[model samples]
Target: MACMKLGSKSDAFQRQGQAWFCATGLPSDIIVEVGDMSFHLHKFPLLSRSGVMERLIAEASEEGDEKSCINLPDIPGGPKTFEFVAKFCYGVKLELTASNVVYLRCAAEHLEMTEEHGEGNLISQTETFLNQVVLRNWKDSLRALQTCDDILTYADELQITKRCIESLAMKASTDPNLFGWPITEHGGPMQSPGGSVLWNGISTGARPKNSSIDWWYEDVSTLSFPLYKRLIAVMESRGIRQEVISGSLTSYARKYLPVLNRHQVVNDSSSRLEPVGLGAMVSEEEQRFLLEDIDRLLPMQKGLVPTKFLFGLLRTAMILRASSSCISNLERRIGMQLDQATVEDLLMPNFSYSMETLYNVDCVQRILEHFLAMDQITGGASPCSVDDGQLIGSPSLTPITMVAKLIDGYLAEVAPDVNLKLPKFQALAASVPDYSRPLDDGLYRAIDIYLKSHPWLGESEREQLCRLMDCQKLSLEACTHAAQNERLPLRVVVQVLFFEQLQLRTSIAGCFLVSDNLDGSRQLRSGVAGSSEGGWTTAVRENQVLKVGMDHMRMRVCELEKECLTMRQEIEKLGRVKGSSAWENVSKKLGLKMKSQMCSAQEGSVSKQKNGNGKNRHGKHKKTFTPDPEA
Candidate 1:
C-alpha cells in the first residue's frame, strides 16, 4: 500500500504492513486490501485536515479521475473505508500503492477506463456507429446529391442524414461540374423547390437556364450557412451579377447586425464605420444624400461629385439651388452665402479665371505704365526704356545714318499710305520745312532719279539699287561719275583698275592694249600709210596689229603661268619645311649635342651681361670677341 498525501502542504508517507497514509493533512486514512492484506488508516484532526480534503476533492473533480484508498495506522479510529469509496465515486480515484505512486499515471489510467466504460463512452460509441452506418448506406446517396438543397431534402426524407452534410457542403462548394449543373438548368441531384427560379423577377425553370441555383437563391435571404456557402459557389460558377450578390450580402449583414453586435462587433473603439460594397442596393434619395455627405467630407468639395450618376444629379441640384423661388428666404440667404463662397473659390489664386480675360493693347499699356510708375517711384529703370543708354547704347544720330538703318526697318514694316503716330522728335522734325531732309531730300531724290531714268527696272531692282547706294554712302560726285561713265563701260574700267591695283600679271597685256593712244599723231601717220596699201593691205595691217596684241597677250599669259607654277612650288617647299619633325635631327647634325644647350646658352648670356654690368660700374669695359664674319 502507498500513502497518498492530498493536501495544500505536501508530506511523504511510507507503507507499513498493508497500509500507509499521508502524515500532513487528511481527514482520514483509507483502508486498503492489496492481495490478501487488510489494514486500517490513520485519521488526522478534522479542523486541520478539512482544507486539504476539500482541495484534493476539488482537484480530483476537475481532472475527472477516479479516487482510490491508501490506509495508514496513526489515526484516532483507524481509517474510514466508506468515505474513500464515496470520494472515488464523486472525484478522481488516485492510487497510492507503491506500484503506482505518481498521480498522472493514475489519472491517465482512469481516463482510459472512463472512455472505455464510463458515461462518456456512450457518446463516442454512438458517433462511431453513426459514422459506420453513414459510410455503409449513404455513400452513394451523398455522392448523388451535388448541392445543399438535395442534401437537405434527403436528410429530411430520412434517406440520408446530417453525418455527411459537412462533406457534401465542401463538395458542392468546390466541385465545378456538380455545382455547374444546378446553375445551368441541367438535370442534377439538386433542384430549387420552386419549379421556376427567379432572377431579377424573371422566372424560367426549376433551375436558371442561363445562371445558377445559387445566383437565384442569393436574393432569398433565408439560406443556412452551408446553403449560403453552396449558393455562393453557384453564383460564382454562373457569373452572377456582383451587384446582386453584394446587395444580398449587405442585406444579410443588416439582418444579422444585432446578433453580431452581441459578439462585441461594436466594442472596438478604433473601428469608426462599416464599409459597404459598391454593388450594394440603395434608393435614389438615399444615394443622393450619401453623395452629398461624401462631398462634404472630402477635402476638395467644390468641383467633386461623389459618383458619375451624382454628377448630373448634383448639377440639377445646383441649378435648382440657384433659381428655385420655392425655397424660403432664409434658405435663399444661405444659398447666397454658399454661392459667394463658390464664387470666391472660383476667384481664388489657385483657381482664378481672371487670366482667361483677354488682354488688349490698352491693358498691356496700362500694365507697362504701372511698372513704369513703380520703377520711377523706386528710382529704378522704366520697363520700356527705348532710350536707356545701358539698354540700347546711343545710336548714330546722322540723318543719313538714321535713314539708312532705322527708317528702313520702320518703313519696311510700316505702310507709307497709312498714318503712324510718330515719336515726338520725329513729329517735331516732320513739322519743320525740311523735316525729312536726309530721307526725303537726298535718299528719296536719288531713288526717284534712278527709277525715273531706269523706267524698265522693276520695283525690287530699284529698291536694291537704292539700298546699295545707301549702304555705300555714295556722294553725288560718285553717282554722277557712275552715270556719266556708264557709256565708257565703267565695269571694264573697274576690272582693269582692280587688276592694275593688284599688279596681277594676267591683266597687264589687256590693260596696255586698251590704254593705247590710237588718236595720237604717230597713230595717224601709221593709219594713213596703212590705208595707201589698199583695202586688203589696210585689213592686213589691222590684222597685224591685232596679231601683235594677241602675241603680247599670249606672252603675258605664259609669264603668269610660269609665275603661278613657281609660287606653287615655293609654297609646297615651305609647307614641307614647316611641317617637318626634324628639329632634333638638325640640331644633332649641327653638333649641338647637349640636350639643354639652348637653355645653358641663355643662362650664360645672362650671367655675362650681369658680369659686364658689374665691371662697367667699376671701370670702362671693352668687348674682346669680334662679330662672326659669316653672319
Candidate 2:
C-alpha cells in the first residue's frame, strides 16, 4: 500500500484508441509501440530520457529517415508498464507503489532509463523506492515480490525478488513482537504494522499467549507455490523452527491442494478439479505434483507434524495417484508417530483400482510394521515384559500400547467389509506385538466383527483368526461373550469356557481368602463401642454376597458340564461320520480331556464349599482337590 509520487505535474496524456498522445499541442515525432499499445509523443523527451530510444532515433536518422517507429514486443511488463515509463519520460504525473514498483523497475531497466540517460531518472528513482520503502515494510515487500512472477527473469536479474524474499524471511525468522509488525491468522491480519507497540512505548499485547507461533503462515500462504517454496528454503536456512515451517507448508497445501480440504478425490469418471478459488481449479496433474513437492518439503523430524495431517496426506496421495516414493515416505513418517493416531485417521479408504477391500488394509499393515520396527529400535516399551505381570489398561502404558488400541479399533471398523480377506485381516491384527496388547478384549471384538461379516470363512480360517487373541488375556465379559458366540470355532469356544472356569475358580479362592481375614477385621472393629452388632451385620452381608457368587459359579460349572457332554456327542458323531483313524483319535482326545477337566473343576468347587463349611465348624484347614494341570 506504500506509494511514491515521482512527478508533481498534472495529467498531460490522453488516449485515442490504442494510441496514447501527448496533449501539449505538439506534433508527434516518435511512435513507440509496446505490445498492442502505441505512444505518440515528441522525440526530444523520449530521446533525452531513454538510451534505447535515443539509439533507435539516431539509427533512423542515419538511414535517411527523420521519424522512427519503434516496436517493443518483448518488454518485461508489456504495454501497461511501458505506459508508466513513457509518462515518466514526458514528466507527466506518475506514482510508484509496491504493486507497480517492481514492474516499473524492470521496464526502466529494459529501456536503459538510468541516471546516465538523465539525472535522477526512472531506474534510480525506482531503485531508491525499492531499497528504502518496499524492502522496509513487510506487506509492501510481499506485494512487490508477487509482481515479479510476470517478469521473473528480469526480477531475478535485478535481484528484486531475492531481496523481497530475504526481507520477508528475516522478519519471519525473528519474533514479530520484536519488530511490532502485523501478524496474520486465518487469512486476516491481526494488527496494523507498529500496532503491537503503542506510541507511548507500552506494548498493546504481546501476541496473545494462546495464538499460534506460526501466525505468519496465512500471510505467506497467499504466495504462488514456486515463490512460497523459495521463501521456505530461505527461512529454513535462517534457522526457523521446523514446526513453524511445517505449519506454513500445511497452510500452503490447504490453499492449493483442493483434495486435502474436501477429503475426496477425482475418480475415473470425472477428471475435473474442485474450485480452489473463484472460477479457478488446479489441474489434477498440478495437484499431484504439488502433493509430492509438499511431502518432500516436510521436515524429517517426527512429532512436529500431527499424525492426523499425515494420514490426510496419504489419503490425498492415493487420490492424486502420487509417486510410490511419496506415498511410502508418508507411511514411514506416520508409523513413527503412530501412537498419536486415532482410529479415524487409520481408516483410509481404498482408492486403487487393483485393491478390493473397502479400506486400505495393506497400507495400514505396512505402517504398523514400520511402527513396530521403530518401536523396537527406540526401545519404546517399558522394562516390564508381557510376562512380567503387566496388564492392559495400565496407567503407564507405552506408545505401542496406544497404537495397539488404535489398530484394534481400526480393525473393528474395517471388519464389516466383506472384501477384506481372512489373510489380510489376520496379518494386520497379528502385526501388533503380544507385549503391546496385555489384554485381548479389543482384538477379540475386532475378530468377532470379522467373523460376523465373514461367515463364509472356513472353520480353519476362523480358528486361525481367533489365534490372534489369547483366551487368558480376555476379560470375563469377553470370555462370556465368546462362550455363547455361535460364530466362534468349536475349539475356541472350549478354550473360552476353560479359561472362564479357571477365572471363576480364582475368584472363589480370593473370596475364601477374604473370609479368612474377616474374623480379624471384625475383632479389630470390636474396640469401637456399639459397633459389634454393625460388624456382625457387615460380615453377614458379605457372606451372603459370597454365597451368591459361589452359587453362580456352581451353576456355571453345571452349564460347562452340559456343554462338555454336548461337545462329546458332537465329536462322537464326527468320528462315526468320518471313520478315519486320525479323526477318531483326535475326537477321543478332545472328549476325554474336556469331560475329565469339567468333572474335576466341578468337584473342586464342591470340595471348596465343603471345606469352608467344615472350617467354620472345626476351625481347621482341610486339603482341597486341585484340578490336573494338563486337563
Candidate 3:
C-alpha cells in the first residue's frame, strides 16, 4: 500500500524510508519537519496576522525533526484541515506534535494572565509574595513616616514622649533604628559628669557671662542637671543658642518630670521628696509669673498630655483641690440665689405667667356657664333639696353633684309617667305605686352608702355619677316591657329588678337602702322623701309603705294571671304595641298611618299556608293574596 495517509486532505509522497506528506490546507508560514520529511502548511490569513501561525512555526522548528510526515492539528479554520493532514502523515509519533505544544503554551499563557481565566493558583502565589515583602520591610516603612517634618514638629511642640516619637516613626519605616541614635553615647546615659568636659566644669572662656551661655547653664541646672549637661554640650558644639537650649530643657522637664517622679517613687522611697512649695520659696511677683505660666500650660495640657499624667504628680494637689472646692462652693451659692430668686420672682405678678393660669380662667368660666345652663334646663329649680334649717344646705353643688340631681329628677319625673301606662303594673296599682318614688329614694340611698363606704369618693364619685346621667335618657319601651313581662309590681319591682340591675352593672355603687328589717316590713324609707319639719322622716315612711303596697298588689295580679292564663294572654296581646289597640293609639299619637293586623306567630304561619294553597276555608281556590308592601 502506498504510505497510509494520516489526514484525509494530505497528499501522499515518499522520501528515504519515511513518508513525506504535505497538508492540503495549512498556514503557509507553519513549516513542519520531522526527520528530513517536510510538510509545508498554511494557516488562515487571520491566524497568520494574529500571530497564531508564527507561534506554530516557532514550535515546529524547535523540535528539529525533518524526516517523518508532519501532522497538522486543528487550526482556527476547522477540524477538516487537521484530519486531512493527520491522514497523510506517517513515521511520526502521532501525539508528540508541534501543534499540541503550541496549543498548550497558548492555553497556559491565556489561563495564567487574563482575569477571565480563573487561575486561583497563580493569584495565590502573587499575593503571598507581596505580603512577604511588606512584612519584611515594615521597619523601612516606619522610618519613612518619621521623615515627615510635620509629624516631627508636632511631637516636639507637644513635648511628646520618646516612646511616642519612636512609635510614630515606626509607622513609616521598616528599620526604625536607622533614624534612632544610640541612647548610651552621643549625649546619652553612658556619658557622666566627671569625665564629660561639658558637665565637669562651667564654661569660663571669653563668652559674655550674662549672654546666651549663662542662660543655657541656668536652664540646664534648674531642670535636669545630668541630662541638661549632656544636652548643653551637644548644643554648644552644634552652635545652638542659650535660649533654644533653655526652651528645649523646659519642654523636656514639663513633659517627662511626672513620669520620672512616679518611676523614682516606686524604685526608691527615700528619693521621693516633696515637691518644692511655690508659696514658701517664690515671692509674690514670682508667684504671679508662675500662675501666668500655669494658665498658658493648661491649654497645652488640654489636648496633648493625658490627664493621668497630671494626676500622677503629687505636686498638682493644691491646684486640683482648689479647683474642685471652688466649683462646689460656687454651685452652693448659685443654688441659694436660685431659690430666693424664684420666690421673689413669683411674688412679682409680671414675672409669673403660665399655661395653668389660662386653664384655670377658662375652667372657672366654663363652670359658671354650665351651672347657668343646668338651672335653665331644670326650669329654674332650687339647688337646695329641702327648706329645713337644721339640715345642711345644697348651695350650688359641684358639676358632679348637679348632674346627679339632674339624673334623679329626670328618672323620677319620667318613671311615674311611663309606669302608669304599663299594663302589667298599672292594672295592679291605682297610681303605679309611684315607681319613681322608690327609684329616686333607692338611688339617693345608694349614693349615700357609696360615700360612706369609700370616703375617698368625695367629689369624684359625684362627678362620675353626673357624667353617667348626662345625655342619658330612659328607654321607655324597655321599661314598659320590663314592668309588664317581669311580673314585678310598680313599687318593689322597680327597686328589686331595675335598680338592682343597675347596681350589679356598676360594682362601684353601694347598697341601695339601709333597712335594718330584712322582712322589708319597717316601712321602706325614701332618701329624699320628708318635707320641712319631721325632716323628710314622714315622707320617707310613706314612700316605703307605698312601695310595699305596690309590690303586694303586683303579687296579687300575678296570682290572678296564673289562675287565668287566657285572661292574662288576652290582656297582654291587647296591650302589645306591635299589633294591639295600644299600638294604634301610639301610632295615632305619633302621627303614623296604621295597617293593623292580629299579631300571632301561628296565625301568621297559617295565613302563609293558606295563601300558598290558593284556597280559603270555603274549599274554593281563592285568588292569591299579596299583602301591600307598604303595610
Whole-model lDDT per candidate: 0.32, 0.75, 0.29
What is the TM-score ranking, best to worst? 2, 1, 3
lDDT tens digits by residue: candidate 3, 105-188: 222232232223233222232223223321122222122222222233332332322322343223222232443422233233
lDDT for predicted candidate 1 compared with the true structure: 0.32
Residue 520 miss distance in model 3 (angstroms): 70
The residue ranges of model 2 lying beyond 4 angstroms of the native Cα positions read 179-212, 263-281, 382-397, 520-631
The digit string of per-residue lDDT tens for model 2 on 1-631 reads 5577887677888898998988887788778888788898778888899888889888876887666787888888888888888788878788898889998989889889988889999999999999987787666777777788888899999999899999989867766665554444422344434223222443343232224577567667667778888999999999998988998898778766776667544232232222212223368888888889999999877888888888988998999899999999999999999989998898888998877988988999999998888877876655444642365454445788889899999999999999888888888888887777878899999999988998888988887788898998887678767766778876787777667666655666565566667655655666655476765777676566556555555555556556556665565566357657867676566656565555656565665565352111112222223332322
lDDT of 2: 0.75
Clashing residue pairs, candidate 2? Answer: none
lDDT ranking from best to worst? 2, 1, 3
- Looking at model 3, report the run of 10 residues with the lowest lDDT sum: 592-601
The sequence of per-residue lDDT tens digits that candidate 1 reaches over residues 136-211 is 2212213212222422442334332343344333332343454342353423334322333434444322233443
Measured with C-alpha atoms, the lDDT of residue 335 in candidate 2 is 91
Better of 1 and 2 by lDDT: 2
TM-score, each model?
0.15, 0.82, 0.14
- lDDT: the better of candidates 1 and 3: 1
